[model samples]
Target chain A: MMDAWDDYSEKVMDHYENPRNVGIVEKANGTGVVGNPACGDVMKLTIRVENDIIVDAKFKTFGCGAAIATSSMVTEMVKGKSLADALEISNRGVMEALGGLPKVKRHCSVLAEEALKAAIADYEKNRRDISPAA
Target chain B: MNLIYMDHHATTPLDAEVLAAMMPALTSEYGNPSSNTHAYGHAARYMVDSARAQVAQLVGAPRPDDIIFTSGATEADNLALKGIAHAKDYMPARNIVTLAIEHKAVLDAARRLQKENVEIRFAAIDPYGVVDLDDLAAKIDKNTILISIQTANSEIGTIQPIREIGVIAKKHGVPFHTDAVQALGRYEIDVMRDHIDMLSISAHKMYGPKGIGALYVRRGLKLTPIIDGGGHERNMRSGTLNVPGIVGLGKAAEIAKRDLKSESERLLKLRNRLEDGILRRIEHVRINGHPTNRLPNNLNVAFAYVEGESLILACRGVALSSGSACTSTSLQSSYVLKAINVPDFLAHGSLRFGLGKSNSEEHVDIVLDLLEKGVRRLREMSPLYDMAKEGVSIESAHFSRHARGK
Candidate 1:
């Protein structure tokens, strides 16, 4: 029924409609993609690292309203924070910032956290590989 | 903005004529049909009789007395299946067979019967959501006491090859039952001609009031009473008659019979226009059900790279269901779609649009426009869409497993 929308918070709906930072970060230091096809949602997180701090964060997510909204919220939460602070962005925090997601869609929040951590891991991998050359 | 309702498969708005027909029963004509000696009771009895006749006419039942009113299709289905299952409890036939895509009423009833030691066999459905005739034939052996299938699936709107199924059941000397809840008003049905021995239908699906349904059993069929009470509905079902709901159902049935021929054509025209417009506008979309044999009032499509929930929420001012009514609330992708071999990702993106008599070409256009924009907006933000655009296969990308603690 149309009332199914009531299950989602207004903030969640907003990010789904007008999601911020929706494209890939070209020539990025690291990109993290997390999600199984079985889950019906996959998230890709991109980060620009400068002086050990995330200067910009962007995401492209293929998923439900909660998944997309959570991805957008995670991007907004991590920008202007150090890698450690960004890593501290928990799934519960992302859900809280978006008001809340339904019980069934709470995994979208977990996907957001997992994707962010995966991106940071990729950045560290890049740093480890390039520091020897520098 | 006024929302345009397109999810008629879930339920419909009560028609004005049905409301008018039901109003007297609810108020001034409020009398127990059982107390037939009194004037008030006589009036109520007459209304109930007329309603029974009207509904019988709608389904071409040989006798109105064969119709037993229940709470809804769920109850009707439970009564038809469980009643027959328990009635033949001592017989050698200990198994029942039904389609994988049947409504929860039949499925759950059969499941309960299974728990009580009745072997339940679920016939597989083809990728198009049609019950595989070969699989069905193999499942219905001499031990299979009853075979139940839906005339039209509520989720995908795929109409079954019911006549052939009925003939098979007849050939095997088994009683064939169909959950015709979705097909009652949309298609013409004749119990005898179709070889259907028992059938179920609900009122709300046909623009009648909710909480009222009927089960039609062929004459001379032996059945045990499910709801035992004061001997109402020929002792098969016993309860106070729902006079208002029955009246509304009768009026709806009468109107449906009169309008079905022309209404189906109109709905077909509207549905095709909606489907064609969305297909032309959207980039990676697939219609879920049978292209030609689907219900005229139904359109189900899966939009690539768009999540089912987000797409529905994004398309404001148009009412739709991401899945069928029964399973829509669950986060799980549609089981019907899964049974039909729709990939999990595409299954999650599917939406069902059920056009009703209330819809028009203008409404169709508006819905198509909204759907196109909504899918685009969501896909734009989708990483999977991005990968898909770059010729990446999403299924191949996610073969790795994850280990996360924080």
Candidate 2:
């Protein structure tokens, strides 16, 4: 009988209802996908990087409300940040930024964090390939 | 906010007539039924007896005395499973046969009996969540004390062939018990014709008050008391009677019996409309439960690439339930869906819509619109959906294997 929205914070619900930077980031740079369909959560993150700084970040996520909210929050947190700074954004940071999720939903934040880190890792790998002496 | 109550399988609002019937017990008619010395006691006893007869009539029990009131269906189910299994006469037969998709009330109690060295065999369910009668009969043997199966599943709404299962139990001379909480008023259940030894039902599921249910024990069936107290209800269950709840249950039963035929047809139509609309509007959806033999009021569906909880939340004005792992505290999807061989990814997206007396064509249309929009929006944000659109095989994706080893 509990309302499905009762456990969510306003900020979480806000991001879930109006996600930031949704969809793939054009044809440039790196894409990181984490989680999986079987567990009911999969997050795909894409970043458009320029001069080692993430200028654009977007996400495509298949998950619960918390998962979507966390994905949205993490993308906003990484936008305009350097690759190193974006990598420092942890799962706890995403949760805190969204005013914390339910205890059971904390894993969703972890997925967001993982997706962001993987995207940065992908960008670094692509950069290394492009200029070997950089 | 007028939220559509589509989660009737969880519980129902109390009927007006049931509340009216219960008001007397809650107010001035509050006297102990056992205290036979006073006029107040006589009045209380008369009301209790009448309510008992009403409940007995609803289920077609031969005698009013056959019904033993309990706290709710959970207690009734526990008593039917444990009380019968632990009975001195049946102790020698230490095995029980039940379906894999029974409610936790029956399954958990059977599990506890397992710790006491009682062998429990779970009969398999087919893709539509129907019990395989052949598998059930094969599991029953000379050592089987009881064959317990649900009349209908709450999650998927698949109505079992209870009469056939009864015949199987009778052939093997095993006591047949059914947790009929979901099917009590929705389907025609006659204990005599079905050869049912015990059946559990709850009032709340039938639009009565909560905290009142009964276990119908066939004449001459012996069951050990689970709650040993003042030797009430023929010494099988002991406690002070919940007079108000009992009156509510009795009135609810009477109303259900009177309207069962018409209400079922109405619900079936609304359910079909909802089902048909969702199928027409949504893409890559799969319906759960038996297509024909399911409860008239239940419709469960799995929307691929969209998680169940997210959809339920997105359709905010409608009340619903999900079989997804994210909805449960344990993070495990519905065992009933799992037993029916629904893939893990699909199971995570399963939603149960339980239509009730309040649902109408307008409500169904509203729900369909909300669902279409919700599924579309959620799928838009889905990575798997994108992959599927691009011709990637989601089944071979094996998404769980890459769950960071969680």
The top-ranked prediction according to TM-score is 2
Docking quality category of candidate 2 according to DockQ thresholds: medium
What is candidate 2's lDDT per residue for B114-178, written digit by digit as tens?
98888999887789978888889889888888999999999999999999999999999899999
Each model's Cα RMSD: 2.3, 1.6
Among all candidates shown, the one with the greatest lDDT: 2
The sequence of per-residue lDDT tens digits that candidate 1 reaches over residues A1-134 is 34656788999988877788888876678788887655677788999988888888899887777888899999999888999899888999999999988886776798899989989999999999878765
Candidate 2 regions exceeding 4 Å error are B89-93, B398-406
- Model 2 residue B224 CA deviation (Å) reads 0.4
Candidate 1: regions farther than 4 A off: A1-5, B324-327, B399-406
What are the DockQ scores of the candidates, in order? 0.49, 0.65
Quote the lDDT for B135 in model 2. 89
Candidate 2's displacement at residue B367, Å, is 0.5
